[model samples]
Target: MFALCDVNSFYTSVETVFRPDLWGKPVVVVSNNDGCIISRSAEAKALGIPMGAPLFKFSDFLRQHGVQVFSSNYALYADMSLRVMTILEEMAPKTEVYSIDEAWLFLQGMEKLVGWQEWGHEIRNRVQRETHLTLGVGIAPTMTLAKLANYAAKRWRKTDGVVVLTDPERQRKLMALANVSDVWGVGSRISKRLNAMGMKTVLDLANADTHLIRKKFSVVLERTVRELRGEPCLALEETPSARQQIVCSRSYGVKVTAKDEVRQSLCAFAERAAAKLREEGQFCRCVTVFFRTSGYDTGGEYCSRQGSMTCQVPTHDTRDIIKMALSVFEKIWLSGPRYAKAGIILGDFYHRGVAQPGLFDEIQPRANSEALMQVMDSLNQSRRGALWFAGQGIEKPWQMKREMLSPAYTTRFSDLPKVR
Candidate 1:
């Protein structure tokens, strides 16, 4: 059996972790710059403040209800996630970290160690005691059921934070109770199509004819249904690999009018993408740059282009990626009118040492290239990021600003502010 463990109300829980007084109070974490509501507590949910609702729209309502609001503090949440993962690693002999706030433990051979229920309770209690973060756990023979069990535990099973869906009878009952769209990997479109076919519940989808389902949906989704029926179609990976595409994009605080400012935004995003690729020990052969003006601005030019530049040598170097990205930005540069956002995407990825060449460019000698990358990587590792760059900073003011950012309560030493 594998157990799926998830932190309850992750962002809000992280805030309450350090500030115990915030427990049981309505709390909502906002997007960067306090733009929109991103995560909310159970109390906040009761207020009917929908997710992604702009803060300005409901600011008075939230304040009137005495709801405590926070700007998203990723540094604090990330550190807490790391701590929670560490606790799980020590508790479970073999585990897969599913997300920042979730993990899956392989409990098949641990029957002799302790009762599964006891072990699950101990894990939950210890995390709460040490980290002050609550958890919901689900155990099952398959990942899909494990996910479903997790939802059941977190949503309905209030007395205990753990649920095991190992029995066939119980699985059927749970599937009846579970929504079709709530089943793992099934989205709204799939749910609509399934509902039209009279497969309106999780049990219906699970018990559907595999051949018919496969004919209608793709092979991958059909496998999801099979997995829901107790067949393990997906294998749990020990370490999640880097994504096929790495994107770094953000809207500027103010619209950029000059070509230099657009290039600046693109350069910054390219550097961020390159840093991510290097962090994952990966490289990209193609870099794509794209930009557009505001959607509402009818008078200005609105354009989006996905331009690709092949790497002379596949690289994770910010210098190389930035040069290619900036070159593409120059190609797409528009004068006079302003751009709202620009981004860079790194695709056609390979692991750090994996390389395949094209006919036009001469390949670097493996020994020299490896040595050079190793030295550069070492310098970058030792120093803080951006110790070296491809060129000077793009000639523009730093227009990216988080105007309503809160104090770095738990992450930074200098930015810490008085709570009361």
Candidate 2:
């Protein structure tokens, strides 16, 4: 059997972990610069606050409803997610982390030994008690079915956050009730096409001929259909694959017009991207810098420009990446428009130690690069706050506004919850 575990309302839940009074209250977590609503509590959803609704548009509604609002605190969420995943890793013999908020576990043999449904309940309860984060658990013979079971567990209150679809009859009943779009891998466009073909429900698509589905849709959908029928076509990915690209970007809290401020923003982004590349044990050969004006600004000339530069040698060194990124930025940045956002993309990756040497211009060996990066990464990870490059300026005028950010309760000692 395979089991899917997902944290309920992940960002808002993290916010509530340190503030128990927020429980049963309408709450929302907004995106960077308080741009839009990215996550909402169940009570907030009941208030008809749509996801992605611009905060500016819904500010009055939120205030009228007395909804608690917070800026996204990724540091707190990431640390809490790690703690929850650690608990999951201890419970499951083998597991695949699907996302920051979800994981898939291989529970094949254990289901035969113990009652899987009861075991699912125990996992849910334990996660809630230990991490102070509620999770929904779904157990099934296939990964896709496990995903569906998890959806049902969250959608239906009677399941009480745990659902197991071990019986074939129960699987069919659930599939019949599930919309075609709700099935994994079936996007809105595909669902519309399927609906035109009278395959409106998950069961309709599952009952359709596999060969016909492959011909009409894709091999991926065919696999989804087979999995919907309780066949396990996809195996658990125990290890995540290396990222093909690393993008670091953010909207500025304030509009920027000066070239030096833009350069500072791009350098900061390049440093972050390079740090991620080193963390993944990879080197990037190409760096792209992009900047744009705010789409909402009607008074100014709107413009967007981007440029890419190829490195002479693949490198994860932040200094080299930042230099190349600045050069690209200089080429693309226009003088007039007030820029609202800037970003850097590190791409064309090669695994460390696998980069080919340039023939004409031999790459100079920077013997200290690796050691310097190691020290920087260590200090940053340990939260010693002792390391930063001068390129990343101290006074970031264009930094995103996070005015209502909650305390980093899990990651910082000062932000830990107070008890009397």
Instruction: Judging by lDDT against the true structure, name the best candidate.
Output: 2
CA-RMSD of model 1: 3.3
lDDT at 277, model 1: 85
Error of 1 at 56 (Å): 3.4
lDDT for position 52 in model 1: 90
lDDT of 2 by residue, 327-416 (tens): 887788789889999899999998777756577633444789999899899988887447777877889999999999999987789888
**What residue runs in model 1 are displaced by over 4 Å at the alpha carbon?**
157-159, 296-302, 336-338, 351-401, 415-420
| Per-candidate TM-score against the hidden true structure | 0.88, 0.94
Error of 1 at 174 (Å): 1.2
Q: After superposition, how far is residue 312 of candidate 2 from its true place, in Å?
A: 3.8
Q: How well does candidate 1 score on lDDT at residue 279?
A: 75
| Predictions in order: lDDT | 0.80, 0.90
lDDT of 1 by residue, 84-159 (tens): 9999988877888887899988876786888777888999999989898889989888889989999899878563
